[model samples]
Target: MSGNSRYRILFAGTPDTAVPSLDALVGAGFTIAAVLTRPDALVGRKRVLTPSPVAARAAELGLPILRASRLTGDAGRETLGRIAALDLDAAAVVAYGALVPAAGLEMPRHGWVNLHFSLLPAYRGAAPVQHAVIDQAAQTGACVFQLEEGLDTGPVFSRLERDLQPGETSGAVLADLAVSGAELLANTMGAILTGTATAEPQRGEPSLAPKLNQADGFVDAARPAAAVAARINGTTPEPGAWALLEMASAPAEEAGERPAQQRVKLLGAVPEELPEGTADLPLGDPLPGHLHRGRTAVHLQCADGTVRLVQVQPAGKKPMSAADWARGLPEGTRFQAEATAETATEGP
Candidate 1:
């Protein structure tokens, strides 16, 4: 509706990524009827109960909230009915992490809209932002689209483009998009309410971004160096990508002779071009997973090149830079992980 229409809107989301749009609506004077967020769950150091980030923010802003696992079935249907009966001009979702179903989708007078983290028709699904970084996409952006029953295939109301800076973390990219999407939403929604909003059909071939799982972080040194480096940057900060190590061969383990085995997460890395004449073949003489420099660089030989390790953390240990941890390792230490070991045993 117009900026001055004083329309009632239902907001749905559950994480930090959704906060910006919610805040923008309040700031722009939209009448928010209720915030629909996930139920509180146990989390962190002491395993204490914690509210969904969206819920916490909504409470802070004095907005009513509707917490539900998913809006389905008769019980959920009743909730949807109530939401629809609220005379909401529109319902908006951003990273809500649940399906709205047809019931809720039909409730609002203006239907539902979603603030997806990727450019529409590209990277359309859960984990789009993370996948974009991992895949090294040239660019990524946010798209505000009217929600259909299908997943993220709706016609776009508006889209904003953003460049994916080198070595940008997924969290950073998401934060950037959230604010961008909020501004776009405020403008686009204002237009739709005032009869100026336009929806454009997605033209390119459809691609999917499946939800990322814990196993997605496992990194094997045998792959090409570029792939390994990309994986490291893509999955950092959560479900962190990592490799395994044999304690006896581990540089850190050699000094203290501590545990017999360990798992180390590679949070960050720096890829280096190979020197000439290192390998007899056209490729340089980098040995997969073998450390070239133990301390300063945590340098390792990959399939075709070298990667200088930056940040790392052993299991149950705080993260530290590779240079800091390398001091304790021997001069010729190597990194070995379970995935590599399994591959070795499995044979080529």
Candidate 2:
């Protein structure tokens, strides 16, 4: 809005990440009438009725709250009723899991706007942050756009881009983006109120970022080191990237053609430098399952080359240095190959 005007805002979002945007809008002089967040639900092992971080912050700011399941039927009608009653100029959504219906989207005098995690027309979906890392993107950023019917198909209003660092995790990237986007949201709303914000249609090829799951963790060893590293960092602290490794000494007969016990999650890695004198092994020669070092590094042979595992978290174990896990590995153990491998052999 202009320096002279402050728009009445109805805010919707559910996580701590959304807090900065909400607060920035308020700080930028927008009048936040009400906040719509999901109802309290069980989270974590305790199954406690945990309030959303956004809701808690809203309460502190003394704004009214509407905890609804969605904007459809009773829930939708109820939310719409509240919005109409608020007489808001517009609504701002940031990572709000619930869908905004057409009626709901049009409730405010102006219209709804969203603070999305990625540049529009790219990484448009539920898990954009994770996907960018998985794809080994060179860069990614946040965008503010007009809310539309299709998922993140909104018209762009403003954007802030950043380079993707080699060691950055999705969680870290999102944390920074949320803060940056929050400030941008405030600025955009300010401009809209003042009639300075300009809207533009999204350009470039659109990409999808589907919700990540446990199975998304499987990464082929045949992929390049850079790609593998990106996947490992992108899926951290959640549905992590993993690959199968079989013990080397297991009977070739029992292992069939390929030997592998199960999948192992990769948490951290660094590229290994080729030795000076020895000839570099081809992708298929040494195979992918060989645990290269006794400890400190996992020298798994992959498609393009080898990757050293710096840290890892096996299915049930806590995350630890790969060196520690190596020492803890059972003696006389043999590494197994990927399920797709035709022949598994113990590394000499």
Candidate 3:
């Protein structure tokens, strides 16, 4: 302890997920020198420029704020210079989007410890939480580790594991972890500041979780129903899982344009079981992404089984039950990667 006082540290992160850790540090009586976050940028559907969640939280705490941008070359150097002037005992990072070059990493006395949202040596990169859900991982958790130049290849201080539940979206799972991890992070800090914590290099082969894109949310009919459900869960409340629901037969319009596809975001779903008296369920024979109805539910065929879309939001429309959508569809409609104008020529 510095003169039996709270450890003076720097907090750096940008997203809402990172807010809890900073708040925990304050609760633990850490003297935060300054909070560093990415510069405010355009956000939301209306594209409003807004401060990062970390910056806003810092403001509420009355902590000094440092707005950093595009951490590279001269800009990186300038930011490092300002950080050095703060004379931090340690720096704690959680979900900070920018990579801290080794130059900045080496400046602190205890070095920078990152609160990564994963068990080290697995899913070791950005978007780990979402990747874990997409991959249907049975378990995942948080790791408090020292930051190194090679991705998440750092020495681990502590970890807190959490189970992945069926149909639980990454957003929900992470919300739980972000709050719990904050306490784990605060406890780990107390040990480090008092010189009791140990750092061990991560073990096992590491898997990379590259950043996800819009294409990742595309639900393919060729995948298993369980896989589709996982994709929907993984991508929900973000870029979102989507499908182009269509049919084989349709009235031809004089304009010759392919009818605009029903672009619906998958918010919730469940694997469908063969209902009583239903024929032996076809896992693969049906056209993949084909839509069907069972009295009150909407079912989509996949390579291995069927899934019921519970909640969906059509683009430009409010969310509604998938059953309601199915009620309006022709008996044998299917989903496609994209509809073609040429398909309009196909007979009913």
lDDT of each: 0.77, 0.77, 0.83
- Which candidate, 1 or 3, has the higher TM-score? 3
TM-score of each: 0.87, 0.85, 0.89
Candidate 2 TM-score, true structure as reference: 0.85
Model 2 alpha-carbon miss at residue 294, Å: 6.2
Q: Which numbered prediction scores highest in lDDT against the true structure?
A: 3
- Arranged by lDDT with the best first, the candidates are 3, 1, 2
Better of 1 and 3 by lDDT: 3
- Write model 3 residue lDDT over 268-304, tens digit each, in one string: 7777764654432457345566676667777777666
Instruction: List residue ranges in candidate 3 displaced over 4 A.
Output: 1-5, 247-249, 253-260, 277-285, 337-348
Which parts of model 2 have CA positions greater than 4 angstroms off?
A: 1-5, 245-263, 271-285, 331-348
Candidate 2 vs candidate 3: the TM-score winner is 3
Candidate 2: tens digits of C-alpha lDDT, residues 1-348: 444235688999998889999889887777888998988889977798888999999999998999987889976797789788998898899988888888877778878989999987999998898999878788899999999888999889999999988867787888999999999888887777667899999999999998899877776665555666677778875677787655554577466755446667888655564343322343535555455553235565554556677677777778888878777665434333343454322221
lDDT per residue (tens digit) for residues 177-264 in model 1: 8898998887777777778888998879877888887788877676666667767777876568787665444645568765444678
Note the clash tally of each candidate.
4, 21, 0
RMSD of each: 4.7, 4.4, 5.0
